[model samples]
Each structure stands twice: as C-alpha cells, then as structure tokens.
Target: MENKVATIYKNQLQEYTQKVGKRLPIYQSFNEDSENFPKHRAKVLVDGVEYISKMTHSTKKQTEQKVAKITCESIFHEESEVESFPFLYEDPTLRKSILNEFVIKKKMKPTYNMISQEKGQSPIFIFHFAFGGKTYIGEEAGNKKLAEHLAARTAIKLLLETNADTLSPIIMSKVNSDDYFPKCSGNLQGESSSRHKRNANTNNERRNKKRRFGN
Candidate 1:
C-alpha cells in the first residue's frame, strides 16, 4: 500500500538518480528476512551503496517505500542538487581520468572486461585490480570506453571510501606533477592546495627520491 508520502519520496529518489546519472534505485522485498508477522522489510541499493529500512511494513510495496524514503533522506538533504555530491558531480568521462591518476600513482594496472549477467540484458562491465597482494573486482556501459568511465566512477567511490586514510599518502607523493591529475575545482581544489602547502617539504623529498631511484 503506497501512500502519498511514500510515493512522493520514491518519486524524489527517481528524479535524484536521473539527475545524478546513476542507476535507478533498486528495491528488494527483503534484504534480511524478518520474523515479524508482516514479513516485509525492504532494502534499496543505489550506486553500489545499500540502504535497509529499520522497520518492516505490511506489504512489499510499503517496504519498498520505506527503503526509498530513507535513501531519499540520505541523498537529498536540504540542498537537492548535483553539486551536493561533490565527488560524483563531475562528468562521467572526467571520473575515468581521476581514477587513472589514483591507480597509476600506485603503479598498478587495472584490467577491465565484461561478464554475462541477465540473459537478455546487456553484459556487465567488470574492472579488476590488485593491491596489498589481493585481487579485487571493480563495472558497464554501451561500449568499452563508456563502460570504463562508468566503471571508473564506481571504482573511485569504493576505493576512496576503502582507502581514505592510506590513500592520501599515495596521492601526495605525486604532487610534483600536475599532468597526473584531472581538473579540480571548489572544495577539492581548496583541500588539495591546503594539503600540498602542508606537505611541501615531503613532496620535495619524495620527488628527489624518485629522481635518485629513477622511479
């Protein structure tokens, strides 16, 4: 039973996804089974991030609304614009360049391919990379290039979250060259400048080390 409130939030989520160019919110009847009588607890996964409702509802559709409502609340706060998501606000194509900079700075090569998914639907693009001696799967679009960009965006988000603390040093070492980075503006540019200024001597030492070792 979808009520007016539920429908409005769901609609908002749909519009937000479209605006952000992400896949539509996918609602599941139950991500974790419930022992309650209604037995309808829902979850939604968008942009590889999952949101599960805390409470169960009477019907599957209601449960779906619960997840959708929560997802909407999380993404679309007081400000409802693409700019709200700074990291993801860039064009999908630019994200590829950023992802490349991150991976290449670590001297790791990413392997990309496609895998069979739904029988009638398009194949799923898959990206792979290795770090700390462990292989990780990382994507799909119409063609390889497009798929790579899409995959890059996904990988960047996941990796940035996964490597939040350690990744900064990996990035800081490459500050000697501007060629390795994509165009940045606003908060990214500001924070980058602050970091660069803070680590000026470190950057110089790393550059000198690279030169001496021919790395």
Candidate 2:
C-alpha cells in the first residue's frame, strides 16, 4: 500500500541521513583547515581535562603528523624554546552528528564518554583545576589524546577556544564532575516522554479515523 511504502521511505531516509552525518566529523578531522571543520571548534584534551584550543590548521604533511607525533622528547626536550604542541582537526560534521545523536535522535543520553564502554578503557589524561577553590573537571578521548591534552594545559587555552569566556565567570568556572548535564533537564524528560506518547496516540487515532471513513 502507499502508506506502507511511505513509511519505508521515511525510515530509509532517516537511516541514510544519520549514516552520512556520522562520517562528516571524522572526515573533517582528517582534512583539517577546511571550513567544514574549523580548529577553534575542536575539542582538545590535556592532563585529565578537555579544552577547546585555538585551531591553527596546517596543510603540510609535517603539520598533520605534528598533532599525532607528540612525545616527551618534544614536550620537554632540553632544546625547546617554545612549547611544542600538536594540531587537532575540528571536524564540524562530527560535531553535528554528536548534536543530532543527543538532541534529535535522543537515543543516548548526552554525556561525554570518558572511557570506552565496550572495553572499560580510560582515556589517556585527567587534569583538575579550580575556579577560586572549587575543583574544575575536564578529560580527553581518542588516539590524539597526548597532543590534545598538551594544548588544553592552561586557562588561556580555555578562554581562547570556547564561548566559555562569554559566560559569567561564576558559572563558567564552576568546575564540576563531567557528569551528564542534558541541555534539557531531567525533570522535563518525563514530561517530554508523555508529550511524545500523546502525539503518537493522536496520530494513530487520526489514521484509524481516516481508514474507517474510507471504508
């Protein structure tokens, strides 16, 4: 029937869009400097904290590898004048996928996965800071952990990289545990569920009414 075909098409479209969305951030990560993946938007992990950094994109092979090649030698080499740090690709597509997964898909609760769920693996770094006296929390993920961590080493890094600077220092600097803080509050979740159920029931009733009228 036409209704069955329309439902199949909608499902297929949703799946296809999600699949493509997931690949955008990953591809943008590799093709650093493209407008699709701006550096300022990329997340950098330092110590045990994740910070946004000033994304300086490098097109050369040396620069691409620079981010992945961080070592103790480069980080603290006796000859170093300035701190040697690696570059990160800020893939916008990946970010959009994440937003969609949390905001639109609403399948997974929006939380930064500090460890691999499948393997119980922890990320490479963990750094703590303070806003006055309270603890500030941050963390890192993925293979570029070392390089990313080094970049997130200072308050300056945080200030320069994210919109955090725009927030009141009191709230922005409240260093809390990296817990799941959904943009939508937990109390509203039940209300949202109820609304969705009501909408679904309404739609089904309408469909049934249409069928009955046609018969």
Candidate 3:
C-alpha cells in the first residue's frame, strides 16, 4: 500500500501551484470502489482546467498519481522547453501501455525511429521515441523489442524528471527509480490519505445535492 511516487508528485504539484500563485490542487476519482474490480481513474482541477489520467489503475493512489504527474508536466512546461515523463510498468506489456496512456493524455502519437549499428559481428539496434518533438533515445540492444522498451523507459524517466527540477532539492533527490515506484512512502502520505478521503466525501455529497435538485 506504499505509494511513494504518488506522494511525491502530489506534494510537488501542490508546491508548484503555490509558487505559481495557483489555488490548491483538487482531485476526484471515478469508480474508485468497484465491488469486483478495484479500478479507478483520477482527475485534477488545476488553474481552472481539468486533467484526467487516460488509463485506469488498480488503486486510487496509482490513478491519482498518474493524473497528478501529467498535470505537473503540463503546467511546468507551459512556458519552457522542459518535458514530463511517466512511471512505466516493469512488465513489457504494461510498459507499452504507458506509451498509449501518454498518447491518450497528450493527444499526440509518438513516432518511433530506429537505427542499427554494426557490432563485433552482429548489429545492435537503437530506438528513439519522437514524442512532443523531443527525441528520447535508448541504448543499443540485441533486438528490436528490447531496444524499443529501453527507449520508452528512457523517455518516461526523462519526461517525468524534467519538471521534477522545480521541486525542492529534497524532493528532487527522491526521484530515483527504486524509490519512485510503489516501493517507497513518505511521512506525509497518511495526511494525504485523510485529505483525499475528505475530498471524496465532499464530491459525493455535491453529486447527491445535484441529484436532489434535479429531481
């Protein structure tokens, strides 16, 4: 139940908005308590615009983190050349899903380009994903699939970290892969969880009020 990456993004995003004179970030989730499938998608209201994560995740934290990370990317790079990356899943299939998620969220299809270099005897393949006019290049690999994943992984790493520079030095230093995934947690997560529960309850009450008025 550790959601380290999500906590980092949530805190950094809040701090970023504060620095830029924006209101506190607001979050809402869809289908977060499914009886059978614990699937959910998170949306954030920032600067009067709503940004929702394209893919549904198994947990509320994951979905919220995805949306928050993308929202951070949008606001951080709005006036600069910096870009945002996402957390790619370890499984190859899930890793590719992250790319699809990006396309859905960004409304841009990334074109991949590959080049092969001759090694001692065989050739090594290097792949690059051309996304948002930025080229994320991967290391040379023995085959095409591995090379493609490597490139995608590199893109996710760089895209997310670019905006992380705006975070505090302590938060920026915590963005390592080992800790950025689900394996790590912060002391603030407990407070965050409570705040999210309150927000969720408020959202539900508002929805009910709307229904009552409509009826």
Candidate 4:
C-alpha cells in the first residue's frame, strides 16, 4: 500500500522537476502472469533517462511513488555533478557578463537550489539555466549568486571554446575583448600592472614593425 509519506515525496519530486523546467513521467505496467492481478510495476523518466523500481508493489500508487523517489535521487545527483569547472569562480564580473549576454538576453529564467547547509559550514548551492532546450548546471558555491555566476561562466566558456561562431554578435564581442578579463587588486596589483605595461609595449612594437614593413 502507498503511504502518505511516499505520496508526499512523490509530490515534492514532481514540484522539483517543474521548478527546474524538466519533465518527469511515471509509467506503470501490470504483471503478465495474471491479467487481473493487482501487482503493478512502476518506472520513471527524468530528462529522458529511465529508472525502474527494484520490485513491483501491491498498488500502482506504491509502485509509482517508489520509482519516483529513486528517479528523484538520481536526477538530483546528476544535476549536482554538473558543475565540472572550478576556475569560473575566480572572475565574478566575467561570469555576470556571460550570464547577461547569454542567459538573460535569451529570456530564460535561471533556477537555483540550496543543496545543503550544515552548522559551521558554508551552504552548497546549485544554479540551473537553459538555452536552446538544453539545460546547463553550474558549479556549486557557498552563495546562490556565486553559484549562478559560475554556472553562466561554465556555459559561456564551453560555448566559446566549442561553438564560438554560433554565439550572438554581442556575446562574441564581449568574449573577444580584454575588458572582460579578470581585474587584479591588492596583492596582485603590482604584477598585473607590470604585465599590462609589457603587453602595451609589445603592441607598440608590433605596430611600428607593421608600419616599417608597409604591411
């Protein structure tokens, strides 16, 4: 029999899927040994991936809820692992720029979830965003906004590296500009300043060489 707790978990799972903009479908099948038997098998599909329950239950609702719980856990685990890149956290400005150019401009909502919070520990947050029907998950962070930025940065970096020509002109311009590079301050200020000067001198030398060669 399907208890109230299982029902609640099932409902919560459904709500979570809807909040994340993913479709979760629960499918039920009957035992073939006896057409009139009450035993039912349940399976669920999350993001097109299917998960089946370990065994059939007495009622369809029980079977469905069991399958739903298993599927929900799997979905959450996969989404949590989506944050594969750790370097995005170093540049929040560039991250925000990526989000503004790609996600915000595309008119898709960014979803966030606080995965865990323990006493004396930073909260773990996950960010989710979709583009062209494909959802991208961001690396987990201590704060919601940071997690969102990380996610946006990951998506933008992946797109820029793999599919730059497919990006919009505005985003492409931002990616190509040195203005979007990470700014240094405090302890790193001296090093960054020296590096900038070196780059400028190199550019001037290149320009002078070009002029001399008439090319």
lDDT of each: 0.58, 0.32, 0.65, 0.59
Winning model by TM-score: 3
Better candidate by lDDT, 1 or 3: 3
| lDDT of each residue in 2-82, candidate 3, tens digit only | 365556567778876787898999999888566598879889999899999999998777888889878876776654332
Candidate 4, 191: how far from true, in Å? 64
Mind giving the per-residue lDDT tens digits that candidate 1 earns over 1-215? 12544665677677778888999988878534545656688889898899998897778888887788788668756753332333231344345445555655566654544543543566555554444454445354445555545555555555656664544443333332344335433221344456667799788999999999999
- Greater TM-score among 1 and 3 belongs to 3
Sorted on lDDT, best first, the list reads 3, 4, 1, 2
Ranking of all candidate structures by their TM-score, best first: 3, 1, 4, 2
Candidate 2 stretches greater than 4 Å from native:
1-188
The 10-residue segment with the lowest total lDDT in model 4 = 80-89
lDDT of 2 at 210: 93
> Between 3 and 4, whose lDDT is larger?
3
Instruction: Return model 4's CA RMSD, one decimal.
Output: 16.7
Q: Give the TM-score of candidate 1.
A: 0.34
51-169: candidate 2 lDDT, tens digit per residue: 32233444433222223223222323453222211111122112222222222232332222222223256445443333322332344444444322322333323432342333223
- How many clashing pairs does model 1 include? 1
